[model samples]
Target: MDAAFIHDNLEIKFLILYIAARVSRPIPVEGMQELTLCDSGIDYFSFSQCLNDLVRTEHLTLSDDGLYAITPKGLRNSEICESSLPMSVRLLTDRNVAAYNQMLLRKEQVRAQVTPRKNGTYTVTLHFSDDVDELLHLELMAATRDLAQGLADRFQKNPEQFYTRLMDTLFPKE
Candidate 1:
């Protein structure tokens, strides 16, 4: 992945889509939103928009449930674009599971906190402190840059609407 591929983009949607693909699950809005809060502010909407860009490039598919899943092409892209991305982990803990369930009860209120997407679902909203966003932004930029550069080298065309596919892959907003 070339850094330049993502340098032109300031969004973190690609990261979300890739994560979702690895998990092979329909990522809820809140789940994706959580990713942005990890270091910066990569919110669900932005991520979803990036997936949309990927979809435009025929890299992903949008399901009726409003969750974006990886297509065969997306999986291949994941392999080809592997070098430019970062690795994430999946954890399972009984205590954590209990805690997450407890959080779900307050989901509505949590979603309400975000100004723009108050009407949107929390499954797609991410919340974090100020410091986290700053750190995450830099980390995401580095990773995305690599993915973009790698993609540039692999694809015959520059992929004009990469961001849109990224968004579709993340949210399938429509």
Candidate 2:
């Protein structure tokens, strides 16, 4: 939760993992930056530096084909940080891929059948399976909107507090 941790370097790292987890593919740097951001303004030097730092620090692993994925260390660290707050946080790995894919498929199927409201927002319907805890299709927009709620919770409780704690954990800003 460190604001500094949310800086360009960390954001890029998270974005990489998020994209990899979602696509379930080992994404190249070019594709990752291009697809996930509005602009690939991050310089190659800086991006490679971040990637190297994370890899050297054991946060990510890169394939011979230039595909990148989170390391066990990275995944564990992210889960620990996410578990600090209540959110839709979950572990991403091969074991969870099947369930995640099924859920994603259901979400897509529901989205196709919905009509948008006057505000141009559509409701996502959910078809439940015994495996999932909830039976609700989450539209992309709705899911993004709800993304901030967890962040807001941290802010209300003093945004800097968690950041400070994270800073101590990561950089130990003494």
Candidate 3:
């Protein structure tokens, strides 16, 4: 209705497109919400609506895996309208997207393996490694494949937390 309200709404939509454009890989909805809503103070409902609108308008595509990526039209729109956004907002978006991408890379590097054993059991091996060396390698036997897969999924989600808890449990200080 009012000029300021319309401008703010456009800015938010543009900001979302800008982020999707800058990232190398598709960003999941939760990641986008975490960055925009939690880190940038955008209202959760507004942010979700903006994302949905972008998808509906063909500015963004929601992938089969549920990740959002900017379309060609969205990229063009960002290139043209990005200068209208505040410098502070632009800088914050860039930094947050970079950090989010780095986290995704780290998650990808963490490996999980599920193996079916001859004894009608499953073996789940969790590994956390970097460029040089393997930081952790743990194996657990599961009575069912579902259990093994669940452990693998959980480990992949937050290996650092899992490692820290394991260390704290095993080497409790006196």
Candidate 4:
């Protein structure tokens, strides 16, 4: 790989702050790791220390669930100094942040739950939605808890495709 556009700790901190401020919601450490490591100049150790420093300084917050979010101070600083970052780096950051935000939106839109029944079977309730409307709601019975969880997990991964398949099965084209 070629050299990174950013080569200093302050810039690395700015890059981190920039990404966090642009994210749609609080993200786990893994998500932050993915966004911050896009540059060759940043190593895991430096990223780790910079992240902890931001938390200690109250520029970012670590939720009880281990999600990271930009605080008011962080956003203000990012807005003021983000232009100091190279245009190419900022563009790449924007592109990456946009893609991650889309995935976060999709995860928010699809949901599933598995519940156990005293009758020894499990029930899976599923919901699928678009940006503004609920497209489908259904309850299914599974023979086992594991099966129920698997069903829910698969649906959550790609609810649109599952719904389309169900519609095709129920009402095939003539």
Best by lDDT: 4
Question: What ordering of candidates by TM-score runs from best to worst?
Answer: 4, 3, 1, 2
Report the C-alpha lDDT of model 1 over 1-174, residue by residue, as the tens digit.
112223222325445444545552554556544542343334445555776776677766666776556678777766665555444311212233344445543332222121222433222112222323321111111124345344333321322243346557879877
lDDT of 4 by residue, 126-148 (tens): 98888999898899999998999
Candidate 2, residue 12: how far the Cα is off, in Å: 2.9
RMSD of each: 22.2, 18.3, 6.3, 2.1
- TM-score against truth, every candidate: 0.38, 0.36, 0.66, 0.88
Compose the digit string of candidate 3's lDDT tens values, residues 1-174.
Answer: 011222356778888888888887898888887766533445777888999999999999999999999999999998998887777777777888889888776866798999999999999988898768888988899999999999999999888899889899999988
Per-residue lDDT tens digits for candidate 2, residues 32-65, read: 5554342243455556677677778877778898
Give the TM-score (vs. native) of candidate 2.
0.36
What is the clash count of model 2? 0
Q: Against the true structure, candidate 3 has what lDDT?
A: 0.82
Q: Give the TM-score of candidate 1.
A: 0.38
- Against the reference, the lDDT scores of all candidates come to 0.43, 0.49, 0.82, 0.90
